[model samples]
Target: MLVLMLSLVLSDSLVLADSLALADSLALADSLALADSLTLTDSLALVLCDSLMLWLVEELSLADVLSLSLALTLCDSLTLAELL
Candidate 1:
């Protein structure tokens, strides 16, 4: 009968819609998971970079202090020689 055929078509359409929705949900979940992992990786890289920068800054500061001390000693010696 025509009514029976129409009912069958409607049921098939509903099933197809449900399948598409489920597929979309799965795809969204996968995308979110990938984004979270990338964020974590970026955060870890940033932490490592920050530590490296701090270490380099400390080393450079130490070298600067040593150079300044040497310069001050040389200036004092020159002054003393001139006075003598």
Candidate 2:
């Protein structure tokens, strides 16, 4: 009877060890997944920022062109009036 009890205890200990190992493996997998998601997020953010910068540059260029056209029109009108 004592031998049987010892065997049962040993089996229980083995089961506990196996469960601990499984838990550790799951935790490691979770950490790796989180790291992968963070990297993807960073890459997407960089793309978004680059796109925004390009849009801003285009808008500024358009504004500069409009301002130059306005200035030229005003100058032409003034010259024409003086000639008259």
Candidate 3:
């Protein structure tokens, strides 16, 4: 579970990296699916995505490796695109 969470974080951190739109959308979709599928009450993925969403609004920025730690820190409330 931890590995899955970490990988998802790392993967999302890679989005908004100036990549091709198709690739970005696909990646975002995959992350979204994973986040949606998680059944845990804590739903760390959701929390991470929430923080990421918050950061996105603040910075209007997305960079590889950006906002990963921020999401990880809010491990309990994360949902899909937690920051968004």
TM-score, structure 2 vs. true: 0.45
Report the C-alpha lDDT of model 1 over 1-84, residue by residue, as the tens digit: 999999999999999999999999999998678557665645454454445446556666877656644554354333322422
lDDT of 2 by residue, 1-84 (tens): 999999999999999999999999999998678558655645454454445446555666777656644554354333322422
lDDT of 3 at 62: 58
Tens-place lDDT per residue, model 3, 4-68, is 99999888867645467768799999978976777666465556556656765665555533555
lDDT of 2 at 72: 40
Ranking by lDDT: 3, 1, 2
- TM-scores, in order shown? 0.44, 0.45, 0.29
Question: Which model, 1 or 3, shows the larger lDDT?
Answer: 3
RMSD, one per candidate, in order: 23.7, 24.1, 16.0
Tell me the spans in candidate 1 whose CA falls farther than 4 Å from its real position: 39-84
Model 2, residue 25: C-alpha shift (Å): 0.4
